[model samples]
Target chain A: MSYGPTPWVQRHWDLRAAANFAAGGAGSGLIVVAALSGARDAPAAVALLAGLALVAVGLFAVWLEIGRPLRALNVFFNPRTSWMSREAIAAVVLGVFVLRAAWLHATDSPGAVATGAAAALAALVFVGCQGMILRAAKGIPAWRSSATPWLIVATSLAEGAGLWWIAAAAHAQGTRTGLALFGALLCVRLFAWLAWRRSIARNARASAAMAPAGTALSVLGTALPLVLAGVAAISTSPAVVLGLAGTAGALAFGTGIAFKIALVVRGAFNQGFAIPHMPVRGKRA
Target chain B: MTRWAMVADLRRCVGCQTCTAACKHANATPPGVQWRRVLDIEIGNFPDVKRAFVPVGCQHCEDPPCMTVCPTKATKKRADGIVTIDYDLCIGCAYCAVACPYQARYKTERATFAYGKAAAHEAKRHDPDRLAVATKCTFCVDRIDAGLAAGQQPGVDPEATPACVNACIAQALTFGDLDDPSSNVSKLLEMNEHFRMHEELRTGPGFYYLWDRSEETGGVPALKRLVEEAMDLA
Candidate 1:
C-alpha cells in the first residue's frame, strides 16, 4: 500500500528539518524586530549574537539531515532556480551585516543603529527566502499554496517581535514598543494563517491534520498574546506590565516553534498518483 | 530534436504488471523500490463500476520541477528530453524529491538487499554511487544511447526500446519519438483521443494515455483507416 492513490505523509524531511525552519525563522525575526525597536548598546549586542547563534543551530540541523555532509558546499550551485540556494546567500549576507552592526555597537558608535537597520533588511530577506523555499515545494499541497509565503513571513515577524519583547524585558529596557509590535504582528499572523488555510484544498491527510492544529495555535499563540498585550498596555504598575509582556512573549515564541514543527513534520504529504479516466470491462469497442 | 514519449492504451492493458517486473529486473532496483509501477484503480458504485490498470513513473517532463529545485544542479534534462540525475554531484538533500509532483524521485541512505543478506550477484551488482542520493527512472538511457551508436532506431529496435515497452504482453505500451510525425506514438496520438496525467500542472509530461477511441467518424480510429487504405493499395 506504499505510495498508493491515497496521499501519504512524506518521511524524507523529519524533525531535523522542522528544527531548522522553527529556529531559523524565530532567529531571523528577532534580528529584524530588535533593529526596528532601535535597540543599541548591550541590548543590540545580545540580539545580534543570539539571532546569529539560533540561525547557526538551524543550519547545523539541516547539515545533519543531508546525506553527504562533506559535499554540503554544493548547495550553492543553483541560486538561479533553487530557493534553498537563495536562502543560503541571504544567510551569508545577514551574517556579514550582523557582524558589522556588532562591531559598531562595541565601539559605542552612533552609526550602530544604521548598521542594525541594514542588518534588518538582510534578515527580512533571509526569512522571506525560507518562506519561498516552502512554497517552491510543488509536491506537498499544504506547502504549495500561494498564501504559504505570506503566512510564513507574518508568523516569523510575530515570532521575532515576541523574542524582542523578551530580550527587552531581560535587559530592563522599556518593553512597551515591543509589546505593541508583538500584538499587531500576532493579529496579522492569525489573518495570514486563515487566508492560507482557506486557499488550499484540504484533500490530503496532512492538510486535515494541519487545520485543527493551526486553529489551536492561532487561538493560543495570537489571542493570548493580544490579550496580555492589551492588559499590559492599560496596567499602571511597571512590574505587572513587564511580567505580562514577558509571559506573553514566551508563549508566542513557544507556539511559533510548535507550529513550524507541525508544519514540516506532521503536515508534509506527497501528492499521490491520480487516474483521471477509468477503462471499462466487457464494453463493445 | 528528438523527444521520447510513451503512449499506453488503457483498453489493451490487463493489469498483469509485467512491465513493472521487467523494469525491476532490468534496473536491479531494491525489493521495496519500483521505478515503474502499475496501479489497480476501481471506481464508481458496484453496478456502474470501472476498473483500470495504470502504469506510472517518471514522465520526463519538459519543465521538470525536480531539475529546477535541485540546489546542486544534480538533476538535469538531457537534450533528447530524458531527465537524469548525477549521483556524484547530488548532496542527497531530498529537495528534488519533494519538488517532484509526480513522486518519481527517491533517496536511499544505505544498502539493502532483496533477502536478509546480499546474494553473491546482488553484492557484485550493488551500485554504491546510487546510495544516499536521488534516483528515478531514466527511460533506459543507456540502451537508447548504445542502440543509437550501433545505428539502430530507438523505438523500432527491440534493444533500443525501454524494457517496460518490450515486456508489455498486451502490446499496450508504445515508446517512440514524439517529434517525428511518422513515429508510432505520434500516429497513435493522432488516431486516438488521449490525455496526460496532471496536464493542468503544466509539467508537460512526455507520457500519454489513449483512454478511448475517438467519438468522431463513428469511433473508428484514424490509424485503422490508414491501414485499410494501405491494404487496398496492395
Candidate 2:
C-alpha cells in the first residue's frame, strides 16, 4: 500500500489480470503438449477444446477487468508497437488451427496429425506473445527483467505438460513422453524463475513479497512433481502409474497458476521516484 | 522543432502544494487523483539531514513507455513532445498505467467530488470523456495551443503556460521549448547543473531538475575542481 516516493504494488491490475496470464499461458501450453504427445481420436479433440476453453476463460477475465468493454476491439489497433496487440493476433491464429485439428481428430480424419502440429506451433507463438506482454511493461522491474519471458514461457509449458498427462491418464493411455516433458519443463521453469528472481533482487519489497510463491513453485511445482513423475514412469501397474501421473500433473498445473497469480498481483511493484541530487537551501553553488 | 519541456528548480520549491492545487483546479480531477504532485524527501542522518521538495508528473518522454504499450494507440506523443491520450479509443485496460515508470497515468471509472457531492463548479467542469479511461497531466496543452494561435510565447505568457507553472509562488517551475536555445527552460538548463530523473532508462525525459547553480558563479565544474586540487597536491 506504500505510495509517494517508495515502491508500491500496482493496483490497476489485480486478480483478474493475473488470471489472464495464468490461464492463457497454461492453455496455450496444453495445446502444444497435446499435439506433441501424439494424442488422437476423442481425447485429442477434448484436449483441443479444453485448451481453447481455458484460453477463452482468461480472455473473459481480461474483458471483465477493462473499464470499457465496448471498445475492447480497439486492442488490435496497435500491433506495430504493442505486444498486447500481437497477443490478440496470435490468439486468432491459435484458435483457427486448434479448431481445425479438433474437427479432424474427432472424426478420425486424415491430416489430424499435421493440423495438430500446426496448432502446437501456433500455441507456442501465443505463449511467447503472452510472455512478451509482461516483459514489455518496463515500469514493473520484476516483469521487465530479461529472464521474465523465459520464466513465463517455461512455466506455461510445464503447466501444459501437466494437464496433458492428466488427460492421457483419464483416457487410459500411456504417459511416458508427456511425463518426461513435464519433468524437464519443471527443471527449466525452476532455472528460469531463479534467473528472474535474481534479476529483480535489487527490489527488496517485490522479492520478499514473491518469495513464498517462488519457494512453493520450486518445491511443489518442480521437485515434488519431478519425483511423482519419476515414480509414475517406473511403476508397472497401470492404476498406480495413472494415479501418480495425474497427481503430479495437478500439482504442477495448480502451482503454475498460483505462481502466476502472485507474480502479476503481488510482485508488480512500480518503480518509485528517486532524486539523485539534493539541493542546498539559500545557496547558488 | 518545438520540443516543450519543464525545468524544476529544486532549491526554490517549498512543498507548498500550490502547484498540485492549481492542477486539480484547472483539470477538475476527481478526488484522490493528482496529476501533479511534489514529494518531500529527507536525506542523510538525522543530525545532518537535508530536505528537498520535488515536483513530479509525466516526464512526457521522447520515447514514452505508455505510448508503446498502449494496445489501442490511445496514448501518443504530439509533435511538440506533449504526450496525450485519446480517451475515445482507450479501452480502459490500464495497461498504460502499469507501463508508465513515473506512475503518472490514472484510470478512474466513476465520477466523485472532493466533498462527497459535486458542487456547481465541479459539475460544470466535469469531463465525461475522461471517466473510465487513462488520463494524465497534459502540461496544459490546450492553453499552449491557444496561446500559440494568439501569437503569444508559452513560457513568457501566463495564459500560455501550464497552470502549475503559473501558480508556483517561488517560481520553481519553468516551461518552454527545449529546442529553442534562448527559451527559459533551455537557458535554465545551460546555467545550472541539472539532472533528469531515471536518465539511465533513456526515456529522454522532457522534465529536468536544476539542483545547483555553480556554472552561474563561474566556478570550475565539480569534477574538474577535484582533479585540479589533486594535481596541485601532486
Candidate 3:
C-alpha cells in the first residue's frame, strides 16, 4: 500500500525529536564549556549539574527514536565498515572520559591535563560525529550540502564559548580564556551565518527547507545569548551581580535550549520525499 | 587495519534516489533518518543553472570528532580510519549530532520505523519503544564484515554494495580502500581533480567526488582556485 501523505501529528513528533536532540547536544556542550570556564564553585557546579540533567533527558529522548533499543548493540559489531558504529563507540568513549573528568573534579583529582584533554577531545569527537551524520545524507540540498556539518561544529563552538564566558565570572583563568573564546566564537558565528545566508540564496529550496528552523534557532538560541553576552561584556557592575550580565547569561542559556528545540522541530517536518524511495511490496504470505 | 573509502563520478550520477532508497531498506531506518543521501545541487540562475547530483555519506575521517565527544564512548575510529558507533552504549544524547560538520547523524523518533511496504503492514509488529537513539550510515558494516571474513577486498562486495552505491543505475558510486594505492578508488582520486565534501576542515574524509569537466571548466574553475588557496591556509 502506498503510504498516504505524511500526517501533521507524525510530522510534529519528527520535528520535536529534532529540536530535543539539537537542544540537548547544545546543552551538553555548554555544560562542558561552563565547567571549563571556571564553574568549579558551588553555584557554578549547580548550574553545570542542571545542564547535565538536561543532557540526560535529551539522551533518553533520542533513544526513544530508535527501532530496537535492545539490539542497538548491533551497530557496534562492524566498526571496520560503519561510521554509525564508530559514532556509537565514540559516544561511549567520550562519555566515560567526560564523566571521569567530572568525577575527578568532584574527588579533587590531581590530573588536570588528563581531564581537560579528554573533555576537549570528546567535544571535538562529538562535533565530528555530527558532521559525519550530515555528510552521509544522500539528498536534501539543505542537509546533504557540505556546509551543514561545518555549521553544526561552528555553532557548538560558538555556543560553548558563549556559555564559557558566562560561567567565567566564577574563576580567574577561566575569565581570560573565556574572553578570548567569546571573541573567537563571535567571529565563527558570523562566518557561519554568512555562509548559511549565501547558500540559502543560491538554493532557494535548500534555504527554505532550513529557514524555518534556522530562524527560530537563531532568534531564540543564538541571538538572545549573543545580546546577553554583549551586555555582560560591557557592564562593569560586578560580573556576577544580579544585573544585566547575569540576566543576559541566563536568558542566553535558556534561549539556547529553545533555539535547539525549534531547529530540531523544523528539521523534522521539513524533510520529505525529495526523491521517493522504492516502495517495498508486501511479502507473499 | 581496515581503511574505507568511496569515489563518485559526477558525470555518471543521475541524481536517482536509488541509493537513498536502498540505504533505508538495508538499514531499516526510520523515516527522517537516512544513513546515506544524494544531493541535487543547482548552481547559477535559471537559464544558466547547472545541476550536480552528489551522493553524500559519512567520510569516516582519519580524525573523527564523534569519537571524542561521546560521553559514553559510543563512537570510535578504527585503526584503519573507519568510524563506527556502539549504539548500545549511546545514551541517545545526540551530542555527536550537533558536533558533526556534515550533519550526517540522525536521531530516531516514534514514527521513523513505519516507512515502505512492509513497514506499512507490519509496522505494528515492530516494537515502538526502540525509536530513541542516534543513527547514520554504517557503510554496510555487516556486509563488509562478512566479506572480510570470506577474504574479500575492503571495498568489493558480492552480496551488495552500500545501499546507495548498489542502487546507482548510472554506477556513479565507487567504494574501496584509499590506503591501497593500487585500489581503483585511489587511482580515480589520483587521476581526477577530485574533491571531498569539505576539504578545508582537514578531517581527511574518505568520500571523494570527481566533477564533470564541463561543469568544472566554467565558474567552478574559479571556485576551485579559491578553494585551493583556502586549503593552503587551512
Candidate 2 residues B170-191, lDDT tens each? 9999999999999989878876
* Model 2 CAPRI rating: medium
Q: How close is candidate 1 to the true structure, as a TM-score?
A: 0.96
Candidate 1 chain A, run of 10 with poorest lDDT: A276-285
- Comparing 2 and 3 by DockQ, which wins? 2
Give the DockQ of candidate 3.
Answer: 0.04
Error of 2 at B233 (Å): 41
Model 2 chain B is weakest, by summed lDDT over 10 consecutive residues, at B214-223
Cα lDDT tens digits, model 1, A34-140, are: 78887778778788878888888898999999888899999999999999999998989999999889888877787898989888899889888888888999888
Q: In model 2, which regions exceed 4 Å deviation?
A: A282-285, B216-234
User: Quick one: best lDDT, which candidate?
Assistant: 2
Which residue segments of model 1 deviate by more than 4 Å?
A201-204, A280-285, B217-224, B231-234
lDDT tens per residue, model 2, A1-285 = 455688898999999989999999999889988887888989889998899888888999999999999999999999999999998888888999999999999999999999999988988888898888888897888888888889999999999888887876786776577778778888999999999989999989999999999999999988998898899999999988988888888888999999999999998888889988998555543
- Higher TM-score: candidate 2 or 3? 2
Return the clash pairs for model 2, or none.
none
**Each candidate: what lDDT?**
0.85, 0.90, 0.57
* Per-model RMSD to reference: 1.9, 4.8, 13.2
Please, what are the lDDT tens digits per residue for candidate 3 over residues B1-234?
A: 447788888767887888888887777766666677777765559795656676766778776655554555668877766688776666565646644555577666555334345455446445443355566778887887777778776555646356677777988788887878888787666655567655555667778777633233324565687799899999
* Residue A62 lDDT in candidate 1: 92
User: How high is each candidate's TM-score?
Assistant: 0.96, 0.95, 0.50
Q: Which model scores highest in DockQ?
A: 1
Model 2 TM-score, 2 decimals:
0.95
